[model samples]
Target chain A: MTQKTDQDYILEVRSGNVNAYAILVTKYKDMMFTLALRMVGNREDAEEIAQDTFVKAYTSLSTFKGTSKFSTWLYRIVYNTSLDYIKKKKRVILSEHIDEIHEASIGTMQDAMSYLEAQEKKETIERALLQLPEEERVLLTLFYFEELSLKEITEIVHISYENVKIKLHRSRKKLYHILKNVVEPIYLSHGSRK
Target chain B: MEAENKKLDQFTKEVIQDAGLSSPSVDFLANVMAEVSKEESLVKAQNPLITKVGWMIIASLFAVFTFVLTRFSLGFSILGDWDLSSLMIEKYEMNVDIPITYAYCFFFLLVFVIIQINFIKKYFYRSLKN
Candidate 1:
C-alpha cells in the first residue's frame, strides 16, 4: 500500500478524523525538535517548543490554505514558537564569552591548545557549532543538515532571499572561525610549520 | 590564511551535513495527541446548538404570546399602546387589542429572556476561557 501523504492526513483532519493528525505529529516531531534544539540550545526547551508547535498547528489547521507545502506551514509555526521562546528568555546564548561556553571543556588557554590537539574532527565541529550564535547554528542546520533550499528557508525565517544569502555567508564565516580555533592547534601539534 | 580558512569552511560544511537531525522523547507524539484530544473535547462542549435551540424556543413562545394578546382584545395601556396589535391588524386586516395580563406576562417573559441571554453569554465566555 502507498503511504498516505501529508495532504491526505490534513483532509482527514478537516473532515473530523482528529486521529489522523497523530500521523503528522509523528512524522514531523523529530525535525521540529531538532530545529527547536538548534534555536533554543537545550533538550527540555526544544521538546516543549516542539509539543507546543504541534498543538498550535492542530488548532490552526483550518487556517492552512494549502498554498504551501504542509511541512513549510508547520515549520513556520515551529520557527516562530522557538523565536518567541528565545525572546522570552531574554538571553541570547551567543552572548557568552567563547571560553565560558557551557560545552567548552577548555578551562585555560593552555587547555584549549591541548584539547584541540586531541579532539576528533567530528567532536571539534560539534563543539564549534555550539560555540557559535543561535542564528548561525540554525541557518547551518537548515541549509546543510536539513537540506532546505535557500528560498524555503527564507520563507521559514521570514527574511528576503538576499538577506538569507548574506546571513548564510556570514554564518559560514562565523562557523569557520569557531572551527579554526580548534583545528589550527592540531596542525601545529602535527609539526606542520605554517 | 585564506587557504586555511577555505579548507576549514569546507570541513565545517561537511560536518554539519553529517550531524543529522535530533530526536525527541519517544512519547512526543502521544503527548501531542493527548493535548489535541483535550482541545477537541473543549470545542465539542462549546457547541452552539444548545444555545441556538434555546433562542428558537424563546422566539416561538414570544410569537405565541403576541398572537394570544392581540386575538383576546384584552387591552392594556402599559404594553406600548397596542402598537404591535394595531400593526398586525392593519397588515393582516384582523381585529386585535393589547391585554393587561398579556402585558404582565410579556414583561416577565422579557425578564426571563434577558436572564437567559445573560446565562448563554456567560456560558460562551467561560467556554472560551477553557
Candidate 2:
C-alpha cells in the first residue's frame, strides 16, 4: 500500500476523520517542535507552540486552498505562532547586532567546526543557536538544517526573497560568531585532555 | 575572498545537518492529539440549532409580542374580513395606559440591549478563544 500524502490526510481531516489529523501531527510534529525550540530556546514553550500550531492548523484546515505544498502552509503557521508567542510573553531574545562581529571570525568557523566530534559538534550548534536572536536563528535552522531552499524559506517566513538571502548571510555570520566562542574551549580540551 | 565564503557556507550547512533533528519529550504526540481532540469537540459543539444571538433575538421578539398581546386589545387582519377566530378573540380585554416609567424602562432596555449584546459576544469570544 502506498503511504498517504499530506494532501490525503488533509482531505480526510476536512471530511471529519480526526484520526487522519493524528497522522499529520505524527509526521510533522518534530519539524514544528524543532523549529519552535530553535526560536524560543526552551523545550516547554517550544512544545506548547508546536501543539498550538497543529491545533490551529487542524481548525483552519478548510481555509487551506491547495495553492502551495501542505508543509509550506504548515510552516507558515508554526512560524507566525512562534513569533506571536514570543511577543505575547515579552521574552527577551537578546537581539544582537550582526555587523559588529569581526570578519576574521567567519574564517575560523569552518575550521573550528571540522575539529569537533559529531556529538560535540551537535551540542555546539545547539548552544550557538540559543545565543542568536530569534528571527535569524529560525532562518538558519530552515535554510541549513531543514535544507529548505531560499524560495521555500520565503514562502514559510513571508519575507521577500532578497531579504531572506541577506538575512541568511547575516545569520550565518552571527551563528559562527557564537560557535567560535563555544568551540575554542572544546578545542583546547581536545588537545590537552584527549 | 569569495571562495572562502562559499567554503564557510558549506561547512556551516554540513555542521548543522550533522547535528540532526531534535525530538520533543516522549509524550509530545499524545499531548498534541489531545489538544486537537479537545478542539474538534469544541468545533462540533458550537453553533447549536439556534445560536446565542438567535435565541436572544427570538426572546426579544417573544417578549414584545406577549406585551402587545396582553396590553392592547388584540386583533388580527390577514385579509378583508378573513377572521380566523382563534387569533380573532378580543384578548386580554384591557385598555392599558403607557406609564412614563414603562417608556423609560423600554428605552433603557433598548440602549442596554445593544451594550448587552456586545458584552455577551465579547464574553463568549474570550471563553471560546482558549
Candidate 3:
C-alpha cells in the first residue's frame, strides 16, 4: 500500500475526524520546534511557539488551500508565530552588532584541524549557530537543516524572491564569520601538534 | 589561502550536516492532541448543521402560520355579509382558543431562543480564549 500523504490526513480531519490531525502534528513537530528554537534561542519558548503553531494550524485548517506543500504551509505558521513572539518580546537584532560581526573575517582563520573529532566540530558548529542573530539563524535552519527550497522559504518569510536570495547570501557569510570565531581558538591550540 | 578556503567550506558543510533538526519532548503530541480535542468539542457544541436545522424548523413553522392566517382571512372574506367580529368570537368559543396558546408558546420559544443564542455566544468566547 502507498504511504498516506499529508493531504490524506488533512481531508480526513476536514471530514470531522479530528484525531487524524495528530499524525500531522507528530510529523512536523520536530521541524517546527527546530525552527522555533533557531528563531527564539530558548527551548521553552520554542516549545510554546511550536505548540501554538500546531493549535493555530488545526483551527485554521480550512484556510489551508493546499496551494503549497504541507510543510511549506506549516513552516509559514511556525515562522510567523516565532516572529510574533520575537516582536512581542521586543528582541531587536541591532544592526550595529551585525556590522561588528561582519568584521570577523573567515579568510584570516587558520586551516581546519584534521585532529578535531567529528563530535567536537559538531558541537562547535551548534554553538556558533546558537550565537548567530535570530534572522540568520532561522534562515540557516530553514535553508540548510530543513532543506526547503528558496521559493518555499520566500513564501514562508513573506519576502521578495530577490530579497530572500540577498538575505540568504548574507546569512551564509554571517554563519561563516560565526564558525570562524568558534573554530579559530581550537585551531590555534592544535597548531603546535600539527 | 585557496586551500584554506576549500577546507573551511568543507568544514562548514560538515557542520551543517551535523546540525540536525531538534525534536520536541515526547509529550508534545499529547499536549497538542489535548488542545485539538478541546477545540473539537467546542466546534461540535456549536455545530452549524444543528443551527441550520433549528432555523429551518423555525422557518417552516412560520410558513405554516402564514398559510393558516391567509386561509382564515380568505374564509372571513368569503363569508361576505356575516359579522366578522361575532364570527371570530363564535369560532373561539366553539373550537380550541388558539390565540392564548399561541401567545404562551411564542413567549416560551422566544425565551428559549434567547438562551440558546447566549449559550452559543459564550461557547465562541471560550473557544477564542487561549
**What is the alpha-carbon lDDT of model 3 when measured against the actual structure?**
0.78
Residue pairs in steric clash, candidate 3?
A: none
DockQ of 3: 0.34
Residue-by-residue lDDT tens digits, candidate 2, B1-130: 6765676687678767877788888898898788888777776666478888999999999999999878984476456686566574367566768999999999999999999988997687569867
Best by lDDT: 2
The interface root-mean-square deviation of each model, in the order shown, is: 6.9, 2.5, 4.3
Task: Categorize the docking of model 3.
Answer: acceptable
User: Candidate 2 on A46-104: residue-level lDDT in tens?
Assistant: 99888888888988999999898898888889899999988998988675555444446
DockQ-sorted candidate list, best first? 2, 3, 1
Ordering by lDDT:
2, 3, 1
What's the CA error at residue B2 for candidate 2, in Å? 2.0
- Model 3: fraction of the reference interface contacts it also forms: 0.58
CA lDDT of every candidate: 0.76, 0.82, 0.78
For model 1, the stretches where C-alpha displacement exceeds 4 angstroms are A93-124, A184-194, B1-12, B50-130
Share of native interface contacts recovered by each model:
0.62, 0.71, 0.58
Off by over 4 Å in 3: A95-115, B1-13, B48-50, B64-124, B127-130
Comparing only chain B with the true structure, the TM-scores of all models are 0.36, 0.48, 0.44
Looking at model 2, residue A58 earns an lDDT score of 84
Q: After superposition, how far is residue B97 of candidate 1 from its true place, in Å?
A: 21
